[model samples]
Target chain A: MNARNCLEVLRKIKDVAFATVDEVGKPQVRIIDVMLVEGERLYFCTSRGKDFYQQLERDGNVAVTALTPEFQMVRLNGRARRLANQKEWIDRIFEENPSMNDVYPGESRYVLEPFVIDCGNVEFFDLGVTPISRESFPVGGGEVSEKGFVISDACIGCGKCLRGCPQQCIEEGTPFRIMQEHCLHCGRCFEECPVQAILRR
Target chain B: MNARNCLEVLRKIKDVAFATVDEVGKPQVRIIDVMLVEGERLYFCTSRGKDFYQQLERDGNVAVTALTPEFQMVRLNGRARRLANQKEWIDRIFEENPSMNDVYPGESRYVLEPFVIDCGNVEFFDLGVTPISRESFPVGGGEVSEKGFVISDACIGCGKCLRGCPQQCIEEGTPFRIMQEHCLHCGRCFEECPVQAILRR
Candidate 1:
């Protein structure tokens, strides 16, 4: 899909999942009500001087994920800058959500930051079957694993390792199941398991 | 920054924080290495079939934050998808990481997915600046607190709250310190504090 079409799909979706790293190298995740996407960038509002804001200040590069029940999803990567002082800009953002006015009177504690990903660099992928998908284009890195990832004794059911899996192969419950059909063997789940329950089969 | 440049920056950054929610409406946070960035999309491999992935499938809107010492940071909002059975696309993604050859070889237990955000919907901000910003248009949000947030008696000091604080205002030492200068009043520290110690005064 072209950038415009891809963006339209993203904007229509409401719920999103965002991923980022902290100074300590640990993955921190959160769910946001407002995700403002514009131009070659992604934008949002949150309390200023918060850990997430602090992290954003220290690092501009980031990844964003948005999902919808229509089986639509969007992920974007870019650099973020905080608008700790742009009232006019902040006001424009708050206008989108009247509810924000009830909570943050002046957006004082709020920060209006925009994450710009070079649209020119953006790679687009649409689920389902599409005649125009460049799915054949080499993705990025090397193969993760051909075989299914091994689940060690450390499986905690906390469900943290689930995000690392792409093929929807890792199952929860007593013993997490690795569906062979969906498994991509990326090893991301294995590496991210808090207890090291997953290993190479 | 261009997508390539943004990717380069993301690659160099060591830690990133990922945010997601469970069925119960509670937020979960973690850190991970940003696997890849495509166009306006960002990709990370997760074990298919896990709760996180399931959650992503059900709800994709998410918030991500990255922190740095240089006081530069990036926060993102977007969506995520699960690569059902696109071997060709997954293969392309795998080609980007040469290290996979040494670790997981030929194995493909992962899924390939991407996210894209609307350009016109994006907003930008900066810390130590005017506190808010948007496009060259007019906005209408109120200001957050400036006297600094409040730390209630519910202090647990799990130090978990500090993870979400951008100002590093909620210090985890002996007794946490809320630095007013850095505090943006995002109240994330307060919202995430397990004991509910932090608050907006």
Candidate 2:
């Protein structure tokens, strides 16, 4: 659907996985709560004393994703900005997430800091359906990433790639076409092509 | 526990999240199957034609993680080597994951290639317990990564870190001690130190 809807889905799956690069540039990931979602931004929080918090402060870049029981997945690659009004944000977060009160308790909650991810590309992928399905949109003026494969002019139109496609998302043409929404980006066709035509964009 | 045990947890989780750095250096992640785990290596597969395959081929580094519903987590960061015995490995993977037959059928399964993470750091974290708990081990001669913060000799042992620690993992000592196993690796203690003696490794 749209960016907001995708984020809403992630919010619904509150316990989502967040990945960030450590100081040494190694990717680190953990399960984090989606504290709140409003407008185009998704919010979450971590304690100031943890490496996760330091990682966020040092490298604002973060990737978040969650797959629902129905095989619906929402992936967001974006910037995590610490909100300015910490108290107000934390208060609102606690109000929305009452269970948090049990962990932080009253004044101790201040140790946690809130962050928002509003600018990035959001992708929705559903594996439950036949041929799969996917869509992407940008949030807060961010650019949608051009991922996956596309057939180039080098196509011999031999239909080799089409036959190998697990999703059967390739359409025959002078150069052939990959149905973006239904494609798995599995690269099965890229290798099957007699002519090196399928290119990743 | 041990590295093998951590990988076993991931294998049990099966649908784990894998993170990789794309060509642009941004983090990209998805739910991938943890096809098999024997001894010190964890196995998985992706079609050779996808960007994921290309990224792995180009970088060889990957991060794998999954959180169980009970709040236990397994995190692995390591080198992913494209196994030499591709056909044999793929066959083993398919045999271990019979449901795959429904998707690929027969010969089409050949498109998927097997990769193994035999060298890496494995971490086991259990959040379900009070004060939390964590441990790290190396896989296949890989070095165990030194992560988290360490209280240096400069520590005045003011106990500020201990008091502020959410997990109460910091113990008072000449330099104050952060019990690595119970430490959240959250930087609260690092920020609480007035003398700024805490150092992240």
Candidate 3:
């Protein structure tokens, strides 16, 4: 599936494991409800009085992962931009999640603010599919860079890197290419290359 | 539930969203399988050639959260200590997870290493239960410090701190007390305390 479809999986599985770095640089994670998924952007809400709110305000960088009942995993790494003029979104959130009213009754719900992740790197892994297919793509709008190692023209077709690759994703050809989709990006091939042919992307 | 039971939930869920800080201090999260659970300790394995293994080696500090099908979330924060002797456990891991053989055949399995979280802070939250029950406990050993704010005898029955508490967890008493479980720990009450009675733990 494409990046937008991957994000759609996040919307289907509303409960996501959201992670953020604390002031001390330790990773903190908790299950957060996905308030809304409009186009390629995903939105979430937290009270201004909560630590989660403070962490987002401080760092903005966050990672979210969700596992579907079918065993598919979608992980997104992005910066959480606080949505301005949240008056309309807050009402939308309350209307979308009525149970939230039980937690924050009446005007107290006004303390909640909405944050949106506009764009970032996303990895979608479908463990339920045969061969466990997976791919990484960019969400929203950005240049998506190939993450795994790439083979340069310096390769003499020695086949050493292929032997060293744990995933065996290297192909036999002139200037052997590493399969970006299957590569683990372990850097083993880069270390094993005699001519230093492998370049990390 | 207690610490042991919280860990049990993690084992039952098996796949957890594990969070680790990258070199740049941004939080990174992915789904990882719990290899084993002995007592309060949880063990996981990853190939030494992978970036995940390198990050753990660089900073053992990690956070793991798993949500059960019933909506129970178990979050554990702690340092991951690499096991010294892998010969014994590696064999056991392969024996327990036969599918791993398909991924890493023969001696290639030796690339994998096991890490254990022996002691940590664990929070058990069950949204399936009424009132959204939640509790925090220490796993393995050491003191279980109160997570949020604590009001000492210095409170002097002052109710000013109560007004500043966002969660309204503070109650009037001989010495005003903040409900540790419900406290947001935003330090609003601590800052507003007239007698400096609120202490963060």
Candidate 4:
């Protein structure tokens, strides 16, 4: 529903896929813990001695995704920064997550660094719903990315996009309208457009 | 330990994170169903009109990851091809996965096409273990990528890398051996090496 709520859902899921690009431009992903979620900010930690850490340190850009048992999915893509107060943040993370102590006992926990993701886009998609609802928004003053397709004003109202849509989310209007919340963003409509009125943004 | 077994584990998990790069080179991920797994191959379906389908059509590159309840994770990064026998594959898929019928009933199922990943790298990582564990291999005669860091034989045996390793999987040997199975590929050892004996491939 909201960025904070979506982050909370991710934190609840705890173990989610954290994806980053390797040095060779190959996508690398691993299951990571979402240690904490505070307001619009989310926190996580990885051992500084791990490849996951190196990738994060070098790239900073990250995409995290988790799906709940209820079929609700939350995706967050943005940049994460290693916290300045390493020890303080790591200690706080450990205190909140006691299970981590078993992995890194005592002072050795410092080997792990904490990172924060406070700005980015958050998309919530629910497959449990009939129409398959979706909502995406930017948090922390981040710019919203123009993803999927946008029908331009050049529309002749041919209704080709409506017919090609899998979800039947398009409706008749002056230039026809796309119900984005229920749209699949499949680009089928974009491809089926006769006059190139549907543009990818 | 093998690609087939790892893919079976993913199939057991069913709902896993499927990662792909978008048109602009940003990571996009979602919870995708592993509809079928036969031999060393894996299969899944997406609506022809979806961005996910488009991404796969343009670029066959994909990374799929799933973690079991026991903390065992399977990662498969490979290229998927659209099958020529779409209808036959879809019907077989539906027979194996009946629930898909609910999502796309009757003739609407034709909108969904099947893709298979038969060749690529598969890595099995188990976090439930005490020291953690990992094994990676190529499947379907695919070339194994040189991922992570490898320590060369220019060993001074300074023990810095061993001390710097978070998993303590390094040992005293001719080259100060790193147990690849337990190595985090974190680059800490590479950074700690004074002679730059460690190399990343």
Candidate 5:
């Protein structure tokens, strides 16, 4: 479809997969509720005290995947940050999603809830870039499971999967080790490897 | 309709009403091309040194409305920000709409083209604040010019419309003025307004 058409499709979807990298160069992925999208700015509220926020502060770069149940996918690569600790910001989010109020009671507690949106929360790491449309995204072919068989040698010294591993079954030594029993078979490590070092056996 | 079904309906539409503010406290509204939507993020590109980006940066808050030719409406509110300026970022956008490359050649010159998206661009800006919904957004309001209109009171003195204005009809003053004659009536100012003070006259 056209560019406007692509946006229309995106405005309809809700869930997004947010991927982040930590100081140690480990990747973490989480399925988050998208709060809003304007222009190229994508906004979400997360706990500033959480690892995600911490990782963001360290490295604002991030990738967000927007997929429709019908198989339409758009991958957005941008940056994120914490906007404000003001009560007005917290109240705005609470007003939009009152259910959040149940999770956070007082304004003091609310400020602690991470009511940050992109307005001031984040800025684009790349200032002179345009937004990509859905058709151009690397047309992902298959869905990778959470866990996969690991193969050594291809490791680039970047420990992405090791950190993404939900069970922490993968170990990082000279070559790294995978505690097979501790592995939940999510295979996320295999899927996220930049060099495809982790093989599904 | 269910959210999924709602998206399906949203996919069939074109032409969105965007509301933003100009520099002199005037509200501007218009319909512009929506590049793509992934999750809550709606991607679009404007000139690097444009009024739209200036106002957007000043205030990330914005409202976007898209209506289907078949009488469906989708409204979103979120914070806007420029995406990172990088080759990969620009390439991704070009991948989607190759035609953009024609307008913007790949190079530092293209850096003047700014990619923007809104993360806080949430749906239901007035869901709890006022009373609005899928029906109230004027889905079938046919033939209404998708032009930008800006009122003076809310204008933040950003002066964005002067350059992008096809007719060069925008005038900046104590309260920004739009020369109705030279105006193409393509309400970019209204849609780009950070504040909602702009409305159809």
Candidate 6:
């Protein structure tokens, strides 16, 4: 699917596991309530006084994974940029999420800061569907280049890269082409290329 | 309330969001199937060719979070050590998980490797419960030292720590003690301590 489909899956799974790196460089994960989805950007609020807030501040890089009821999994990896003006969005967040008032009641809501994952990589995998389909796409806007090995025209059809590919996604042609979707991007084919024709995109 | 309870929750929620660090220290998370649980140790399997396997092999540290249907969230952070001998566990994993046969049928299952999260920290939180109860404990074997600030005997009962605690878990006493269960571990008390009475436990 596309980024829009990924965002739809994320919205369906409102409660997601947000992963961040702590000071010690260890992976720290916790459940987070997704406040709202505005186009490609996903907004979430957290109290400034919590360790979760500190981790996000220290490292904007974050990953969020959510599994839908139908066993569809959507993982979004991106930098969490804090909104420049928190006051502008806090009211809208409370309006959409009325229950949040109980958590941060009245004027105390100011303690919560809103952050957005504007653009990054998004992967959608559906296990419930037959043959198990999975696709990765960029959210918001970015180069649409897939991160995998691509064989150049210099190839002599050696078939070396095909044999070395773990997923065997290489198809025979004048210059063997690597299937962008099925590729694992493990760099096996690039290493096995004798003519140095394999280029990472 | 305890490690056992946390493990119970993990078992019930078989699919969990497993987080690991990439080469650049960016957090990466994906939906992983929890193969089985042996006592306090949680076992999971992944193919050696996948980036997930490579990341775990490079860095044993990982964090897993899963949310139950009842709105209970369980987060487990620990080192994922590969089982010394894969032959002993691979077959068992396949046998236990019948659907895995479709993904890796016949001899293809050998590509999968099993790993275990032996001992680590586990936090149980239930938003469905009134007052939002939460507790952290060590799984496997270790001291149940809370990660947050602990009030030392040097506390002058100044009421400063109580005021600084975001959760308001500190109670009045000769030496104010932080209620470990409700602490967010934000280090606010440690920073606000005048006499350095709050030490991280």
| Among all candidates shown, the one with the greatest lDDT | 2
Q: How well is each residue in B39-105 modelled by candidate 6, as lDDT tens digits? A: 7889998876567878899978899999998988898988898997896798998888898776665
DockQ of each: 0.09, 0.52, 0.47, 0.46, 0.01, 0.43
Cα lDDT tens digits, model 1, A99-175, are: 55543454233444433333222324333222112211111221222334667666778776665554445678776
Candidate 6, position B29, lDDT: 94
lDDT string for model 4 (B1-201, tens) is 788899999999999988877777767788889999998899999987677887889878888998999999898998888999999999999999997765665666777889999999899988898788998878776766656777788889899888867678888988788888986666677777899998875
Ranking by DockQ: 2, 3, 4, 6, 1, 5
Least well predicted 10-residue stretch by lDDT in candidate 4 chain A: A139-148
Cα lDDT for residue B194, model 5?
62
- For candidate 4, please provide the TM-score of chain A on its own: 0.94
Candidate 2 TM-score, C-alpha based: 0.92
DockQ of 3: 0.47
lDDT of candidate model 1 versus the reference: 0.48
Q: Is the docking of candidate 5 incorrect, acceptable, medium or high quality?
A: incorrect
Question: Residue-wise lDDT of candidate 5 within B1-201, one digit each (tens)?
Answer: 432233233334423444454444333333334655554345665543334545566765444554443323454434556677646556666677676554344442243333444333122111221112222222122121222354667766677645444445568875677765344334555555566555555
Q: Across residues B82-193, which tens digit of lDDT does each residue of candidate 2 receive?
A: 9888889889999989977756767778888899999988888887877788998999989986778899999987888888776777887798999999877667777778
Candidate fnat values, all: 0.17, 0.47, 0.54, 0.45, 0.00, 0.50
DockQ of the two-chain complex in candidate 5 = 0.01
Write down the lDDT that model 6 would get: 0.80
DockQ score for candidate 6:
0.43
DockQ winner among the candidates?
2
Candidate closer to the true structure by lDDT (higher is better), 4 or 5: 4
TM-score of chain A of each: 0.55, 0.98, 0.85, 0.94, 0.50, 0.74
* Each prediction's RMSD to truth: 19.2, 2.3, 3.4, 2.9, 21.6, 4.1
Q: Write the per-residue lDDT of candidate 4 for residues A1-201, one digit (tens) a residue.
A: 789999999999999998887666666788899999999999999876566787889968888999999999998988888998999999999999998876676666777789999988999998887777899978677656756777888899989888766677888887888888887666677778899988775
The per-prediction i-RMS, to one decimal, reads 11.8, 1.9, 3.4, 2.7, 22.3, 4.0
